[model samples]
Target: MGTPELALQVEPARWLGAPAPGGLALPPARAGRGTLYAPRGVYLDDRVVVVADSGNHRVLLWYGWPKADHQPADVVLGHTEFEAEGPGLLHLPTAVALVEGRLLVADAWHHRILVWDDLPEGSGQPPDRVIGQPDLRSTVPNAGGSPGPAGFYWPYGFTYVHGWFYVADTGNRRVLGWRGVPEGLRPADLVLGQPDAYSGAENRGRGVGADTFRWPHALVGDEMTLYVADAGNHRVLGFTPPPEQDRPADLVLGQEDFDRDFELPHVPQGPQRLRFPYGVALCRDYLAVADTANNRVLLFPGPPRRGVYLPAAHVIGQANFAESGENRWRAVGWDTLCWPYGVWGYQDLLAVADSGNNRVMIWRLRRS
Candidate 1:
């Protein structure tokens, strides 16, 4: 079947964290609902929006989608107040998600994931449970020892789908999964990229292949497939039936084959190649990938076929597929992006964590 055609607004419909007009020369890094600093992750749904303001070490939550640009968040996590800064309960949070109405945040520097049984209604609400550490106060990587299923080293991204939960244990060079919401520091039921839970070698200390990964950073999937952005390898891998154990991916994107991880020249390469792709999301009939190094996002038709060297059907954050410069190497504008780090998509809205731009841009998507 031919790929479905998709269209996106050249400019964002709404945005957050941009400086006020003529306010500052650079994007502000202050601690406030309307401000952000190098946000690396975002989660968007029909009614809510969440941003991992990574540089500020907090997560901002809007109870409802912001109706205007620079709308202040209604709640904040990881800090005591919107005006406060520095690490409090979170340390460089890199990702956020909502699972069955519960909140999950990847507190990357803390080497853990925090879960809230219920969504917080106000700022400073604490997580109900913790993962990857023995307690909330412990921040050691892999519990201060070798890699293991019960501990994590910079768990940067995660997703929950089909009653299963998965974490991109980035620092460990692995991905971990549980059958359900883990209650404590329980060992992961499945491990990928590495051979086993105790192994943390890059590409398993060998050449890159279908089963190895240098940096497994982000994940998104549906009931039948799971897609992972192996950033360090400069590709994305798709697993069918969401493997229950170590297995080679069934599909590869951004390269000619699984073994070749070479990046194309920095010029306007077509959509078949990727460089440091850090995020992936399934937006209805399309799969959106944050091609981080290219400063753009690629949209592939959904139900990604089992193959290598797949090409994207469309591109975002740039004027066309033949462009790959930050803000197109021009002045920042409503449609430009720089080093976008994360993406989350709902039915018709696509949210991008435009990290280098220090803002989240929400674009309207339409099918043709």
Candidate 2:
């Protein structure tokens, strides 16, 4: 596939959290509707926008796409109010998604997934169901026991596609999938990166391979293809026809091969290499990766063919493909990024969870 004829604006069209003005200093953590602190995940569409304000241990929601910078969120989750911040329910929510009108949150620190039957209209709305734990109040790694199909340990990201729900069970170093929004305490139908549900070793307790992950942080795809950001391995792995069970990936990105997982010394990196890539999203035919440690986002023309190393068509949050620095090794700017952790592409808009900068940016595709 070729790179699509698409371009993203150098600056975001709209943003939430941090003030728009650029600077070199890091912003302080604040709790309120218009502020964010080390946000780790984001979801966007024409109807709604969700941000995982991880530092605040809460999730913020805009009933609709915001029209201004630092717009206040319409609803708050994981807490009773925006200012009350003493670990109410969520320990550190890292991701959010909507499936069939239901809201799903990856309450990462608590090691569970929270599901709300419908979007809540107010703050502190408890989830209708919970996953990874036997009940809502029980929060433990692998349910305080060995790893299993139904347990999670720091499950940081997830997605719903083709009626199936997939989760990046990070601490377990694997991915778990269910046929649909599961009820309660039901085991996943499929597992990836491990020999069985009971295994949770990094790279299967050995070296890296096409079928193992060091840190499976985020994922996106459909029934045709799936992409996972293996952050700890510094690469993204692609699975064709969506793996039905543990299997080797059909493609690898950010490195020359699946066995290599080294992070090059801080310098200008080639388009084909990635350093701690943490997020992946598909926009039309293009793939957007949050090259986290590189402090930028890489956009591939489209899904590359089965190959070891593939180059990206464009780069965002930096001056060029060769530059890899947090805010370009200087002050923060509208076009710069600092350790972006999540990305979402819909139509022509790209939502980025700029984690290090404590903000979420919404960039638009530049029309020719």
Superpose all Cα atoms of candidate 1 onto the true structure and report the RMSD in Å to 1 decimal.
Answer: 2.3
Whole-model lDDT values for every prediction: 0.86, 0.87
Task: For residues 7-115, write the lDDT of model 1, one tens digit per residue.
Answer: 4333368888965343224467788878999999999887679999998999999878787888888988888789887888999999898898888999999998998
Give the worst 10-residue stretch by lDDT in candidate 1: 1-10
Residue 176 shift from truth in candidate 1, angstroms? 0.7
lDDT of 2 by residue, 236-284 (tens): 9998878777799999998888898978858789788899999999875
How displaced is residue 212 in candidate 1, in Å? 0.6
At residue 82, what lDDT does model 1 achieve?
92
Alpha carbon lDDT at 182, candidate 2:
80
Native-referenced Cα lDDT, model 2: 0.87
